[model samples]
Target chain A: MSTTSTTAPSRTSRTSRPRRRLARFGSTGFIAALPFLAPALVAYLVFVVAPALESVRLSFFEWSGFQGAPQVFVGLQNYVRIFTHDPVFWTALSNTVIWVILSLVIPVGLGLVMALALNRKIFGRNLFRSVFYIPGVLAPIAIANMWRWMYNPNYGIGVNLAQLFNLPWLADVQWLGDKNLALYSIFAAFVWQIAGTNMVLFLAGLQGVSPDHVEAAKLDGANRWQVFRNVVMPSLRPTTVVVVVLTIINSIKVFDLIVGMTGGGPAQQTQVLALWSFQQSFNNHEYGSGNAIATVLLVITLIIVVPYMVWTAKQEKNS
Target chain B: MTVTAIPTAAAPVANPSPKRKPRPLSRGRDWVRVGLWVALLFSVLIWAVPLIFMVFTSLKSEADIFGTPAFVPPWAPEWGNYVEALDRGHLLTAGGNSLIVAIIKVPVGLFISAAAAFALSRIRFKRQRLLMGVIALGAMVPIQVAIAPLFQVINGLNLLSTNLGLILPYIAFGLPYQTFILYGFFRQIPEEIDESARIDGAGNWRLFLTIILPLAKPALAALFILDFVATWNEYSIALALLQSQDSWTIPLALQGFQSQFTSSYGPLNAFTIMSVFPVLIVYLMFQRYFVEGAFAGAVKG
Candidate 1:
């Protein structure tokens, strides 16, 4: 937190002047770093990188994950099955895209608004921040329980509100159980959990918007909204970039929430790609198809994140 | 303790608001304060009320749950629901397994990541950027992609359904984030310290062990608390690797409870309320870092 007050901490390394000193011992820089780096390197490669590569390879073959199963080479069949035949595949794919889109808008938007409002030197704001953030940290089981109660067909908020408002149909509406409303309902839960994260990020970003700058702008006859638009938003680009990237990644990688809450149920209505892939492999025993779905998810993430990381890394380095 | 602490550092009296010379308060300012309070209260409704409702329902009997309104607290609160859920859910066994995994994984993972971060930031060497990129990429790749292959690898090693199976991959996945955070902290420490220590004939190992680590305590503490929560709550890999119910973590066991809880809402809320206490306590303890450490990951690009 102390270091964060100065500037973005990640930028500090590259921006620091690279000072190479003549080794007192010998030309043994890599040799010296080896001991420090080897264990992590070996573990990461064996467990993370190699597995990812293996997933790509697994996608092209027909292999049940069961031991002693025949591993037959099926070129493009898994991918083709997902692309052309599986109606659920399209639903899962679109659901993923929709999840990503909704996530980027709702939580991030709410977070920015909360940050702007609570950025003041107000009393009790910290407690309020904790309230918003607690759900995000709570176990998935707890969150699922709360949201399920809200959306319960029998005794949920929908039912109670319907009763109070004299709207009979709302009570019948299955919030988590319905096909049409389920994905968005789960996203509402996501907003409840995630908005706090974005708020915290933007609050940290707002710390960088020097009060002096705002004061100077005020003296020069800039109004509040103008000052915010002109001074605050521009300086918040770095935080925004991070916020957006994290949002998209979280949306794409969203699995546990869907699994815990709905299990992609009510006749497989809320199945996003991540959950769909898990179902295909583990539940359905279509290992090749499952791996294919996984590969699709991996590519989507990389295509989005890699260039952004490179671009942002460059931006942080230069700025 | 208020505005003066941080603002005073850079405030040079050019600012309009001055506590030094008291002036007449403006009418507009009082209205703004009222507006801020309204907004804050509105945010509480959006955020805390559902959580409050969760607590309310957890205390209710089965009759009270369906008979009473959603928001109303029951007249007679019972702790028996919690006892029942705890007994039926097998939460103690699951919690113990989670604790074993997290306690081992968090420290072991942090140490390995710290060593790697030290070299990446401190040691000037070829292939630094390549290694850094590889680790950075590891953080973003979903665990789903690795689950199939990882299950095979764990199976091949005959480590499946064991704590060792869970700990190994958890460490691997946890390394990137911890290393990246520590690198940022370690990089900010002046290299002149490294040069001077080297001049005194201290090896790189000694320098890391004694000097750099002590200075990077804040980052280490923050990451330790954060990593513990992640390790405890992790589910995907655990689902793929853990075959037996005996070895299940909190999340897995909770999922098992979920099927039974679907039929009965009372015990479900009770179980959820009980299960979340550990995460809540830990979060509250390190919450300042919990809120602010989010931005630390932002610049990791």
Candidate 2:
């Protein structure tokens, strides 16, 4: 085996050296990588990349998704209609913005508070951590369903508790049914479902904080809040960036909960970009218009996500 | 590497010095600790209420579900709700479908993504960074953006509503994050190992399979759990693609069951509990790896 191994390289070197040199443009390394990458690349291209590009292409055309139907090129008309003519589009966009802001603040804020509270050597820290994180692990559909039932006007906890407490005004309030309250109610559910994830992430970040720095700050007369603000927060910059970016992306892609809980109901009050895109394309059969909304959503998401991705890649490379 | 380093730095703070006597100020701190405990307990109870309600409602008969307070335990637990969910709600079949999808998709997707990640991390090629960036960006591409064209593509291939259809996209969409994580892992492995293997007349394929793959078992396991949970809980693609009842996953089936049994909270809650139980078990079993993998993917990617 040793002899064959020894001779194999010499023989190949002598005969194949020139060819290998010539194959630099398509080296053995690159060639070998093809089989490794082909399956994922082909699938990603066909299912992800091509479809993304097709969505962009379809945005400029009017088509009902009928097989063999001609796609009429309408040259920005879809965009124009979405921007100027559609009231629902504005509501969805504004709601999406609200979602983005709420997801940014509430989950991040609560997660930070929980992380801080749980950071020290506390009793049942592990139990609390696990319990808090359970919601995040469950399916969003399940969470939404649970909350939907909780928000049920007739048999819901909200109404029943309100009635038990003799708060008639609170008892009669429609949580998911009212246009003004549906989106915020769903946002609250979203926060409950996701805050655990943020907590866990922040805990991980907290673990990385230099305890010595915190101790030093304390020794220098820094109070609890000051120590946290001065020592812990700066060290958690990386985690904070990650949490914020992920929350934004998750907020923008909010669909499952809306679909499960509200279905963008009460005059499309809860309609976000994603749900609206789905409704327009699949439900309304306005393929072009739907694709346009999807394209807008894509652009908006890319605008935020791409830069962060680039930043992450660069950070990883540097480290 | 860095993950290990961070914990070591924090370890000393966890254990106070035994030589130091307890001070009077420590009594004050005890009250603060109590406050913290109270706050944590309150949060835990609040966090658990919805799930507790789910279990309570699932255990009750239809009459009790509406009759009793949401928090009250059932006098006689309706174990038949689970049976009804399985039989009437088609949850077992949907669960089987979910299992099949996850079982097939997770490992297959991991292998494919690991392979691609191996290429990106180990192989010297032009356009490597650009390709990596593109794949990373793919992680952020919302499924809504691709659903329209992807649906059309699946229809064109006549794969829509089939498990294969769902599996394909799950694998595809799962690739970016899996590849990103695996690539980070692969980069951490020393290059000398690959060099020695190459010197021993091992090619790239053998080197990857024999050396690098084994070395990456932790990462593989982490991604395995993460990807499995994701695939199992995936909603949008399954909803859009798997239109037929037989092809529905747990989430899709749960949604359908809820819609069908709008008034019956017992079976609906039972179905909900059943669907989330496996994922919860997996998360609990691998809590360390799950949390680490989750944060690592986001923070280190």
TM-score, every prediction: 0.92, 0.91
- Residues A118-137, candidate 1: write the lDDT tens digits: 77656666677788777778
lDDT at B206 for candidate 2?
Answer: 85
TM-score of model 2 vs. true structure: 0.91
Please give, for residues B107-216, the per-residue lDDT of candidate 2 as tens digits. Answer: 99999998999999877777887898898788887889989989999998999889899999999998997898788888888766766676677767888899999888
Query: How would you class the docking of model 1?
Result: medium
As for candidate 1, its interface RMSD to one decimal place is: 2.5
Query: What shift in Å separates residue A10 of candidate 1 from its native position after superposition?
Result: 26
Top-scoring candidate (lDDT): 2
